[model samples]
Target: MDCNYIRGADLSHDSELNQKALAYHADPKPGKIAIRITKPFMTQSDLSLAYSPGVAAPCLEIRKNPDDVYRYTSKGNLVAVISNGTAVLGLGNLGALASKPVMEGKAILFKKFSDLDAYDIEVDETDIERFCDTVAAIAPTFGGINLEDIKAPECFEIERRLVERLDIPVMHDDQHGTAVISLAGIMNGCHITGRSMENLKVVIIGAGAAAISCARIYRFMGVKEIYMSDSKGLIHAGRNDLNPQKREFAASEGMTQKEAFENADVVVGLSAPGSFSLEEIALMAPNPIIFTLANPVPELFPEEVRAVRADAIIATGRSDYPNQVNNVLGFPFIFRGAMDVRAKTINMEMKVAASRALAALTQCEIPPYLEELYGTKLEFGKEYIIPKPFDKRLIVEVSASVAEAAVKSGVARIETFDLEAYRHTLAERLA
Candidate 1:
């Protein structure tokens, strides 16, 4: 099949399917998530204990020691998934209300994957200061704040200011989620291809939140040379139009996206569909790692890349393909670990640990059930570069790794941390 034809076909969303999605959201429930009371409120005595008189005791204790809120309330296990609806997935800006479903979906994922409760807060304000102020003001109610769907430049500032201001763990999953998961795939890809991080020439197409975060994390992973491109082409040293975030990944010389792919060891496509072609993929160094992550349609499809360079290790943001770099693998579990350890912030150490853990999990033997489910043996090679989101091991592996990192980094508030016991706790929670 012609790749362009496939790309074109994928772009058109079926109205019938769209309506089905809408119906799915509407029927039996108006939204994806709802608040559930953990304690009973059936009797008058239960009500008094649940509220007014009985609540005042914990309130008084919490007033004396602020940290007691975690003990007395659901704050420790609760996370707020806040979004402005500015950048709702690949759909672009659809405003705050329209972004509710996606936010609710995030909450569902949090509950399903980690047993953590999340409330989707769609902040209508677009102004950076107001948005940040609003979240900061309401920050104390939850153990962690998950900033979602906020656009870049402003997103950078919002997350930065929030992290500096709030004591609880704050993370923009759009920025770091893709980065962490992609980094895990890259680590495995490098290992399989016999390439080192230091020598790789990484070309990141799109200087948006994900791209910038990936570039930053790659740098943290000891990747020295990174070339970045946006809608205006290459973000190079000579470009005065570059924002501060883009400037961090700017190369010495500006080049077209096609030119930037020359001899590139890794190509990360976070831009629109058809951003890169098969010819460009052919130009990459031998055993290239290509993460054409543009959703619905990638820059170049897997078949097109394989036709050109069979040695290429390919990944995308889609689930129907092999080595899918889904964010579901990262955010839920990362937050689970963070909240468990009461981490102050989702720092670089925690993120690196998560990536390493994910990469390591793929190398271990795949379970017999998983092999039967996929109808093929799963291994740590080209097609199976990272662990599947449904893989139950992720909860134990990634979460524990992140929790351990948080404690070791001194960011964890809790004094005592036991790794094995924590793993068992996670297993029991899942059970």
Candidate 2:
């Protein structure tokens, strides 16, 4: 049982797995997925109709009526994974070409799970107002606009203005996507821990776009006392050095983050690495729900926090760890629902409904395949507080909830579409 020998133990057993992994990621002769011809398998007539004089029929019709483009082209199923160079992951300001990889990854995920065709378009501007105008001008080319990895505050304004300008669903995926999944995890966490959202005192670290949006969404979901923190300290009511956005949440009476956490039922870390100190965690209310969602590294590790308080419901943003609150669980299904229903915008009600749907999905019995992935017997408990990304039911459930919300909110263009049939259609497309 020597720890030194552990690295060698059964390591080669994964040689096949490693080879398969390497095969899938094989040095990009640009990584495979090419578009080939589909349906009636391409005859001379098909070729002419798709490309030559025959194509002019649809072109002329579309030119007469621009809305006809949706009837003729792939734009109905196409989403543009758009971003500006200001914020690309934890690596900020990498420019348009540099952010293409993340956008391409989004495309692959869209195709893989939802069978929606998507592509990335990284614009070469940093100015928020200009970027907003640019996306608004080009909005017709896509069925949905997915703003990825853009920096906060600016991201907030850009998405707001674009959704206002465009008819299609415009979303800042980092903000709403992260919030949806986080809400899902928190919902399950609350149910398992026997805590209600109304009674919980939540402390969220990081006042970035995700933090702000999540805080607001948490408020919408019934949490009354939400204490958010940036690098300096607590975001309460009116602190002197606050930015316009931070001023809304600035501490009024000088209550520090520690004092805010003293009676907290949940501590959400959306800040930088190591922002959640052990001392800060020990001050939380009993059976606290802690979600350290900082990437690559969490604000605090699950094991480290559990050492301080064993009963805490701990989750992170990493798949290698248990209870991973991955944003992948939210966006694809969300867009799937929105696009299928031809929703005008991804509203807050839809977002909350999707979150509730996600939470509800986890409340059901765990799938057997999850045992290998989670490395634990999954059930309704602190350890199994959220569903894995591979859970197939998530797509249908969350999408239905979102679509229903869209209808209720009057954002949906298709008022009476069959959701069950649509879900089956997506399943067939993916199959």
Winner by lDDT: 1
Candidate 2 off by > 4 Å: 1-28, 31-34, 39-43, 64-66, 372-376
lDDT of each: 0.88, 0.80
Candidate 2 residue lDDT tens string, 171-240: 8988888899888888887887788889888888988878888888888988888887887777656566
Q: Give the least accurate 10-residue stretch of model 2, judged by summed lDDT.
A: 1-10
The collision pairs in model 1 are: none
Relative to the true structure, candidate 1 reaches a TM of 0.95
Candidate 1: residue 244 Cα off by (Å)? 1.0
On TM-score, the leading prediction is: 1
Judge candidate 2 at residue 225 and give its lDDT: 81
Model 1 score (lDDT): 0.88
Candidate 1 lDDT by residue in tens digits, 118-218: 99999999999999999999998899999998888788999999999998999999899999999999999999988988888999987788889999999
What candidate 1 gets wrong by more than 4 Å, as runs, is 1-10, 13-19
Where is the poorest 10-residue window by lDDT in model 1? 1-10
Error of 1 at 53 (Å): 1.7
